[model samples]
Target: MEKVRATRYVLPLREGGSMPGLVEADDDGMYVVKFRGAGQGLKVLVAEVVVGLLGRTIGVDVPDLVEIELPPAIARYEADEEVQDLLDASLGSNLGLDFLPGAFGYDGSRVPDAATAQAIVWLDAFTANVDRTWHNPNLLWWHDRLVAIDHGAALYFHHSWPSRAPSPERFAAQRFDASTHVLADVAGTTAVAARHEELAALLTPEVIRGVVEAAPEEWLETTADLPDADAVREAYVACLGARLAAPAAWLPGADR
Candidate 1:
């Protein structure tokens, strides 16, 4: 991912818990910045990049990701205390998604094609993402195209890392409940099952490692179990690989 410095703080996008802010970067492009010091911690950022790369690997319409450098001086002129505190805490590399100007939140009015819908559902199911429900569709309608966003909630298994060790088998065996998934009805679990191998083939071991590597080293939280960033990346690769290897265990059997 390309790295850019934040030139200006535009505004706080206070929608979700992370409260990603809108900021202009040195490249003269605007991006939605997900802070490293957000309430969700660095794991959210890791999930965002990892899942994002995976989604794009299989041809999902996701935004371009970049590393936004938050220099100390960038927050000097912030007037809002809350926003300033967030900026102060997030004083280094943060995740930046290309801001699609004029993009509106997804509504049932604009539907994705069957192939796209199934791809989205399969990606979410494979990643165990539970946040793409109707109420919180992490999707956007951009210029008549459906775009995927906000994957910070996908890899929930990592949150358990503080205490438990990374368990590939467990995550592999974890069932993905697509009942609340926004594209559940549209994608239909049957088609998702049919395309399992076809989609899974897109994420080769090299591809998985490449996506995991996209995450900045600073963001990969080092637990005692995983001593270094590379180890953590390996752990992610293992978990994802295990899940892909054991589809029957995790793939939703029907449209529930």
Candidate 2:
């Protein structure tokens, strides 16, 4: 992943709870940044990188992600107390995505091609991301292409972290309810199931380990069970690998 410095806090996107901001970076690029200091904490940022990268590897349309350095000076001039506090807390590293200029939210009117829809649905099922529902589709229609965003809600198993020992077995068997998925209609369950072999081949252990390692070291919280960032990364890789190995348990309509 590329690293850039955040030059200015362009604006705060209040639509979601995390309050990811539209930031201007030293590279003169506009990015949507998900801060480390957000209420949900660093785990969400980890999920964003892992799931996003995994999606990218599997031919899914995901925005380019980068590690953005947020200097304290930008927070010093902020007028809003809440946003300023967020910036102050998130003083060092943050997650930023290449901003899509005029991307519109996904609705049924502009559904993607059948293959693309199947790929998205399969990816969501594997990651256990329930946020891609009809009510709040995290997909974007940019330049008439389907762009997936906001995977913070995907890896819910990580939130247990220090409190609960990382459970690859549990996550591996966690069933994903995709009946309400945004692309459920367009992506037939049987069709998606047929893609299991090809899609599964794309996510090798080496590939998964790299995605988990993509997260910043500081973002990975140390627990009694997971003493280091590398350990945490290994835990994620294991969980995802186990899930990939056991598709019938979690892959939606796998039995079909």
Candidate 3:
């Protein structure tokens, strides 16, 4: 639980959109460092950290998301050509995804069954996450299980319009996709079958509260003034409840 500090050395990483220089830290610990001024809000970083921590608790696979405090005084680019090219293309933009170096995709042929997809859909819906589609398969295949990644888009679009109603598009779309696949894979042992009980047992109200509570208060402060801290906490619970109440037989945590 020691917080890792960001330092001067840069390691090359495959570039992600909206940012430059996928570099590794010098501290010997592995992490993708997104510098502070890198276009994204602090909340996105907080969301990645919070959601990642929560997902891991219930058996979901998420990359380790951590914040690296880069020194503004440090000269930005290094001499490395690959890293330099990426930096040049993405100059003045603020954001970076620490690379998940050495991770590879699950064979496209072994596409996930509907049941596990159901769980993924449900999880994203519950969290109000906006990522996860055909374009960027944030779902990584590690150890024969679908690992979730890139949640900087969750609980989003709500920041701007505090009173805005939630959109069901992402939830509906994922459910539709999962249902079709689930039926197709009825013969196989789906992921939900193996871990639904554990996920259910772990996703208690307390666990949800702990993650949301740990979210940076500054992010909340930027939003419309919630009546009080409890009010903010209650809102997140309501959002989670809506997704959980949906009938998802293949949902890993639904029955438990």
TM-score of each: 0.97, 0.98, 0.64
Ranking by TM-score: 2, 1, 3
Error of 1 at 145 (Å): 1.3
lDDT for model 2, please.
Answer: 0.92
Residue 125 CA displacement from its true place in model 1, Å: 0.6
Per-residue lDDT of 50 in model 2 = 95
**Candidate that scores best on TM-score:** 2
- Cα lDDT tens digits, model 2, 103-216, are 999878877899999999999999999999988999999997899999999989998886989999999989988899999989988899999999999999999988888899
Lowest lDDT 10-residue stretch of candidate 1: 247-256
Model 3 lDDT tens row, 55-168: 777656676554444444334656666444444433232233445555675435676665566456555544656566555557676666677776777766445535654443
Tens-place lDDT digits, model 1, residues 125-229: 999998999989999999888999999888899999989999999998899888889998888888888888899999999999999999999998888899998
Give the whole-model CA lDDT for all candidates, comma-separated: 0.91, 0.92, 0.52
Model 3 quality (TM-score): 0.64
Which of 1 and 2 is ahead in lDDT? 2
Model 2 TM-score (2 dp)? 0.98
- Residue-level error in angstroms, candidate 1, position 41: 0.5
